[model samples]
Target: MAASLTLHPDRALPLDREQRAVAREIYGQTAHLPLICMHGHVEAEVLASNTAFADPARLLVTPDHYVTRMLVSQGIAPETLGVRRVDGGPTETDSRAIWKTFCANWKLYRGTPSRYWLEHELVEVFGVDQVPSAESADALYDRISERIAEPGFRPQQLLDTFNIELISTTDPAGSDLAHHAGLARQGLGERVVPTFRPDAVVHLDRPSWRDDVAALAKVSGTGTGDYAGFLDALRERRAAFAAAGGLATDHGHLLADTTPLEPAEAAAIYDQALAGTVTADQAARFAAHMLYVFAGMSCDDGLVMQIHPGVLRDHHAGIAAKHGPDVGFDIPFAAEFTTALRPMLQTYGHDPRFRAILFTLDETVYSRELAPLAGAYPSLRLGAPWWFLDTPGGMQRFRETAVDTAGFYNTSGFVDDTRAFASIPARHDLSRRVDAGFLARLVLEHRLNLDEATETAVDLAYNLPKIAYQRRI
Candidate 1:
């Protein structure tokens, strides 16, 4: 007999009886509250079309780097998992075979946060009764296939069912946002929104930088033949995103450097880049300067700025060359923020309209740099544990290291920054549970009363992201 798939109600609560009881009370207060997913990678077209998901593997496995990365690490080929190759190489087109392979290797995810999320998606989201294993793979796949085919399982309908009060999809700076307009026609515009991401055009070292800049010029109706025109084009695109209900800008620079450049030097570097003669040092300086420019723009327009740096994206050239980017070989390195962001913060850290949420992959800086920096800056709030650091233990560690210095309010609430649509609730639920445990410890330690903990729990789970992203209700 297959192991029955069951989710314990008190899965992540504190182990001690008294603390567990307190955590239970705190979790209950916000467990079913509406989700405010202010930052993620879900495409607007997915919800705008309101189409039924294609299949279990395509919906769950193929698009999620978190899952694919682990499977690849364990000797499973990406092609066998149905991940397409850029060279049009052969891959497993059979979704059922991919599902079976995933199940056979399910044990590889033991003790991982991915396990928690997958189990939640199975039991709670799709109503699966048996745990996924080699014996149960086909049955689970067919069950999920049938469920997704149901009319009520459409993405837009699931948004209501998931209680997502608001969700933001990351879009290129030059996007026309036609899908966003379609969502508006369906009355989902206010709830399903867009976020401006200009990395492709802002980073001078990319191979396609010239082409992206050209596209940006065409979309913004502003020339990018010079530094001034490029900045103008970016500003125009920002305005268009804001008009379409965007509230934040996302930047994923390799470093957190925010030094401004002299106008003449910046212009010369821009000309060199346009002429395909810019050196690596000049490119790095130009990228750093753009961060400062983006911050000033945010201060002027009231769009919250989100910076997540220190990721060495596409660690393996062979995989990246074959699969293109985001097939999950990214690695994180140490990051220095205090010195790196000094110039920008010194200029706008106190600006009333400027709000920057900072994320890091380097946990060592949480207490030493990020906590102190966020604790002091009026314009800065530490974003939740991101990317590789969004695990259960990582979330708990963030509170332990950050709360004493930065406090709860100085930190933005949880963001389910995922491309797997079915994993959003699982991610949020994990965050809420970890937070409840942390707050319960505080309550027991006499640092906070139960009433205070309850209110703060609600804020962390629902209210903080809304306020951080400048969303009302």
Candidate 2:
């Protein structure tokens, strides 16, 4: 018999009787507050098109690295999960087969955040009564297919269903943002926005760097033959994004280093990169220098600068070569923010117009580095626990470690940095519950009064993200 799935009212709350009561109260206050998703990877076209999702497997399994990575670790092939190969090799073509593969291996996701989110999507979003299992896989798939085919299941409609006040999509630096323009025509521009991400052109080491630069030049109407024009092009694109209702820019780098190179030195390296003569060291230095330049640009444009460093992207050479990037091969390394960020922070830390949100996969720096840096720098705010650290336990540890130094306001609220649009509310809901439990403990300890805890819960769930991302600035 298939186990009946249920969502407990007090799921993710404190275990202690006294604290659980307080947590339930705290969670109730903000459970229905509209989500403010300041950073995410959901493509803007998904909302703009308002098309019904193609199928259950493609929507739920193939694109979610969290789900795919676990299956891969268990020796299941990516192709079996319907993740297409870069070489145009054959993968599972039948969406039903892919759904069965994921459902059969459901045990692999136990105790994982993916499990929590997936279960939430199944129960709350799709109204599935049976937990995913080999026996229930076909029924669940058909049920989900029928649900998605309904008119209300379209992406745009789900935004209202999810109670999302606003959601930002990460747009490449060279993107013309036609989807954003389309949404604007429909008067949905403010509710669905773009965030400028320039990593492709800025990171000179990428194999397609030159091509990306050419694209950026074309879109921004600037020449990329010189370093000066490159900077101007980036500035122009940032302005374009801001005009599209963008409130922030996203940066994902291997390290947090933000040292500035002299103008002559920077131009020389840029020339080297253009000529294809730049060494790895030169490329690294140039990427670091761009961070400094971008900081200055933020001060001028008022677009909040969000940097989440310390990810070693595409750790597996084989997987990357086969599946392309963001297939869950990214790994975290030790992060040094105090020293690595000093150069940029010193220049913009006190600037009223400059705002930066920092995230790290390295939890060791929560109190030691990130909290201290955000606490002192008026322009700095700690981003929500990101990537691998966005789990429930991670969210709890983040509040405990960073709040003591940075306080609740200095930390941005939850940003469901997800490619899976259906998982957004689940991610935010988990963060809220974890935060409620954490705050409940504080109240039980008399560290915060009930009124204060309730207010802070609301801030962490909604208000802080708007303030941190300059959405309300």
Task: Report the C-alpha lDDT of model 2 over 1-473, residue by residue, as the tens digit.
Answer: 88999999888888999999999999999999999998888999999999999999999999999999999998999989888899999999999999999999999999999999999999999999998988999999999999999999999999999999999999999999999999999889999999999999999979999999999999999999999999999999999999999999999988888999999999999999999998999999999999999999998889998898888899999999999998988989997889999999888899898999998899999999999988999999999999899898999999989999999989888888999999999999999999999999999999999999999999999998988887424
Those runs of model 1 whose alpha carbons end farther than 4 Å from true positions after fitting are 471-473
TM-score of each: 0.99, 0.99
Whole-model alpha-carbon lDDT for candidate 2: 0.92
Number of colliding residue pairs in each model: 0, 0
Per-residue lDDT of 431 in model 1: 94
Model 2 spans with C-alpha error above 4 angstroms? 471-473
* Residue lDDT tens for model 1, 212-258: 99999999999999999999999999989888999999999999999
Candidate 1's error at 372, in angstroms?
0.6
